[model samples]
Each structure stands twice: as structure tokens, then as C-alpha cells.
Target: MTAGPYPPSMIGLSDVPVSNLAPPTGALVALAVAQFAAISWLGRRCEPALATDRWRRFLDDGNAPLMTVYLWHLPAMVLLVGAGLLLPDLILPDAGLHWWLIRPLWLANCALILVVLTRLWHRFETVRLPALGTRTGPATALAGTGLAAASIWYLWQHGATLNGAGSAGRIAAVLALGCSLVLLACGQPRTRRDAPVRGPELNVHPVRSGPAA
Candidate 1:
């Protein structure tokens, strides 16, 4: 099937004007099959203990900041693209061995930019809103969620642009983000201080002598 031009550096494809070109189906199929087979083989070969407690902790740490990464990765990429366009001499002119060598450097640059921006933007991702109480009921929550969902749908339908006909898309994105904040503000779990506490419970436990004495 035909495919549009994507970042050649990211996919390890040769520099070519791919806007009107279609990649070979056999090549795509082979790549897909190779990936699947490799993954399957690794999954079966690796021991379960490979995921130790330390590994799990590392995974958790990586996952914790992933929301920030996800939010800003696209923006970072856009910035990088803009930079490449502006600084053609420093970034362009890659050919033969130089082009291949620069690929890893370009990837590293993108990753470094992403990491730095993600750290800077991390606070916005962790914004906590006020907890929902009796005043803000489920109806309010539902309304906020509905509004957010509609906003997201509008943006998705409009291609997430703000130029030309996308001014309306920008409005939708704003509304969506606002509704999302509302949902988040009222979505926190109520602590015992906020919620009514039930009466104390009574229980009986049998005491045992140390090893039957």
C-alpha cells in the first residue's frame, strides 16, 4: 500500500523525496515480520527474573515522567525541524559516510531536546486540582468529562491545527484542555477528612502461645 513521506532519519531510509513515492510492500512486510520474530524470540528466551526488583524500580521511574515526555515530544520534534530549516549549513550537507555518522547524532540531539523540555514542562503535567466534594457531584464530573471528550473529538476531527480553518480547532483544543482541568480538579479521591467516617468496627482475635510452649 502507498504511504506518505515520514522522517527518513527516524526510519533509516535514504534521503529521497517521498511525498509522491510508495515503498515496496515486500520490504515493509519483511521489516514487520523480522520485528515480530525478533520480539517473539526475545520474549521466549529471556528469563522472568531478568525483571528484578531493581529493574522494576527503574521501569517505574521511567514511567512516572512519561506523561511529560509524551506531551512535549511532538513540540520538541517541531522545534528541531524548525531549527534544521533555519540552520541548514550546520545541520544539512550530510552525505555518504557523514550522513550515516550524523544519523546517531541527530537522534541523540532530538532525545536530548526532548529530555530537557520534558523536565521543564513536567510541572504542568503534575498539576493537581481541588478534590471533588458533596458540592461537586457526579453530574459535574460527567459534564466535565463530556466537555473534555467533545473538545478532543473536535481537535482530532480538525487535524489539530490552528491556521486557516483551524482557528475553530484551536478553540476546541482550549476548551478540551479547560474541561480536562475541570475533570482533574474534581477527580481526586476524597480523604477521610472530607468524607464522612463510619462507626468503629469490633473484631476478635485468638492469641496463640509461642509454638504451643
Candidate 2:
């Protein structure tokens, strides 16, 4: 006899054995770690370039816009994807085109979403909070959390398959990935703040008598 919807041996699904899923690609993980390390090192080495007073002030004041971009891009991607699917005939014609072309169209849609979201977020005060002193830690944490939560929610809604037992595990994985990126970006040095300036003591010279005569 032929097997039913499920195999005859798998009558009781709960008792059936499940195969282990393969872990994520090691090559991608290694490349990401290397990229983060390189960026961190570059930022630290470039920190001295921002030593000038004016540029330092600007760097200290410009954290808000940067954070705003970091926080909204992923959610915007999801929105664009949904919009593209809903309006496929307009955004991407359903004519006799090669299937591979759809990938580039999807990328363009995502880029458009990113640009729109970044511009909108830049107008908000909360998105542009300063990154300096004690507030830096909290602000970084908050931004990281926001990005992570948004990514996880988006992935869950879109039904991305994961090795997780349920939604909680999938969310945790996405959040971890988002947090990693935030930490990496935060650790980068602000190159705009670097500027050379003479010290106050060097600028002033002691008045001396002519040959002490």
C-alpha cells in the first residue's frame, strides 16, 4: 500500500525522530567577525584625527542622525517587501521575464525603503540623541535594542525558517545578530572629530629681559 499524507512509520509524529539541522555557514561567520575587527581597528587608529575643538564638538553632536539610520533600515526593508508583493504588477511586471531578475528588483525596492525611512527618521529628535559621556552607553543600548526587536519582529512575520523550536528562539537569534552590528558600529571612531591644535602652554611664551641687562 502507498503511504498516506505522512509516512506509515510516522503514525505518531511526536514519537518520530527528527534530523538535526546544520548550523550556519562558518565561512560567513568568520568573514563577519573579520570585518568587525578591521573596522574597529581602523576607527581607533583614526581617532586622533578628530582632536580639534570644533570637529570634536560636531562629532559629539551628530550621533542622533547616525543612530536613526541604524535603527530603521530593517523594518523598512520588510515594509518594502510587503508593498512589492502587494503591487507586483506595478513594481515588477509579471511578464515573461527571467526569474533571476526579481532578485535585483527586490534589492532596489529595499534600497528605496531605506532611503525613505532614513530621511523620515532624521526629522525626529529621539532618533538623533547625542552619543557622549554616560548617555552614550544607554543610547547605544537603546538603539541596539530597537533595531534588534524590529528585525526579529520582521523576520517572524515573514516566516523565515529557523532551527528554533518556536517564535522565541527565532526572535532571540535575530536580536543577537542585530545587537552584534550595533556594537560593531558604536565601537568605530568618529573621524570627523579629529583636528590638530596647539596646546595653551605652547602658545604662550615668557617675557624675558634683553640678555638679562
Candidate 3:
């Protein structure tokens, strides 16, 4: 779907030749616009229902652990798919007669794996953030992000191992990644012992009458 004009996408849903087709640029653009319009209309229609406290809580329940799901979902899928390779007999061929039947099983297994992963990592999404080791400026944060992105791009182009051709580059990339993490970990200001908030002494206090008035 991504390849433009000349090489309009030839990919299919599966090994099914019936599903093969190319999407024209005009069609893709029009479809995208249509989708946006539909979503806008739906959002407007749903706002009143969604504004209720019950719906808000429901939305929050689904959204609160979304980050955890986003982080672990790909890994969970990769692990399951890789593990499937070891049990080839259980997996059907693409577009095979039993493939459709097995799809639900695949989804169920992936969901089970995702649930376990969510249980393990979702706490990070819900937990209160801890203080940073040191306060950092935007420049530091930007530098860290650039370094981290560069490291990922570098390794994605070269290889991760430092045993071969691009060894030096890979090593540099790893170092960049480490430095980025250090910079990113430094945003929190150090806690002062004389801090003015967040305790019975600050947010809450009891008044005492002077010497029985």
C-alpha cells in the first residue's frame, strides 16, 4: 500500500490470488479523506454519550494501560510467531483449507500471551512516576532523543554485532544509545529535604487553639 504510482501495491491479504490488487493514488487519497470525515461525524455523534461519568470511567479503564499494551504487543506477537516456527505441524500453510479455522486459535494464543505480558508490565503505566536524579533542560532532552534515534537508525542500517564490517559504527551506535538513556534519565529535579508540599505538614494541617483562649 505504501509504494506509490508506478509500482502501486501488489501485495495481497494472503496467498490467495483472488485478493491481489493495486490501489491507485487517487483512490487511496479519497478513501483516506472519507475515513476522516466518517470519524469526525462519529465523534460528534458519540460525544454526548461519552461525556457521562460512567463512559468516562470506561474510557479511562481502557486507556490507562494502553501504553503498556503498545510497548509489549509487538514483542508478544514476535515471540508467539517465532515460537510457532518450532511447531510447524501445528501451523497451516498460507490459504490452506484449515488456515481460516486456525486464525481464531492464533488470535486466542496471542491474546493469552498479551494478557500475561500486560499483567507483568501494566503496573508501570498506572504507577506514580518517581523523581528524576537531576533536572534537565529541553536541550538535554532533545540531544538524548536525537542520539537514541540515531543509534536505532545506525544499527538498523548496520548490524548490532561488532564482530564484522561495520563494527566501529555499531559500537558507536551502542554508545549513543547508552548516552541517550543517561540524558533521558536526568530530567527529574533532586528532592529537597525542605520541600514545601505533599505531606501532613504541607497539604494537611490541624489548628491548635492558643492556651484555652
Worst 10 residues of 3 by lDDT: 13-22
TM-score of each: 0.58, 0.36, 0.64
C-alpha positional error of residue 45 in candidate 3 after TM-score superposition, expressed in Å: 1.3
Candidate 2 residues lying further than 4 Å off, grouped into runs, are 1-25, 53-62, 86-112, 119-213
lDDT, candidates in the order shown: 0.70, 0.63, 0.78
lDDT by residue (tens digit), candidate 1, 1-213: 334333233232235433222443445566689999999988777648557888788778888898888888888878887888987766765577766777888888889999999888787778885456434557767777777877777764554556775597677687677977666466455567887878888796997668753
Give the number of the best model, judged by lDDT.
3
For model 1, state the Cα shift of residue 60 in Å: 2.8
Question: How does model 2 fare in lDDT?
Answer: 0.63
Worst 10 residues of 2 by lDDT: 16-25
Alpha-carbon error at 166 in model 3, in Å?
A: 3.0
Clashing pairs for model 1 are none
Q: Clash number for every model?
A: 0, 9, 1
Q: What are the C-alpha RMSDs, in order, of all predicted structures? A: 6.8, 14.2, 7.8
| Candidate 2 clashing pairs, residues 3+ apart or interchain | 49-194, 49-195, 50-193, 50-194, 50-195, 51-194, 51-195, 52-195, 64-128
Tens digits of per-residue lDDT for model 2, 6-104: 232312234533211113234445657999999999889887887879878898777646777688877987787677687777655655564456768
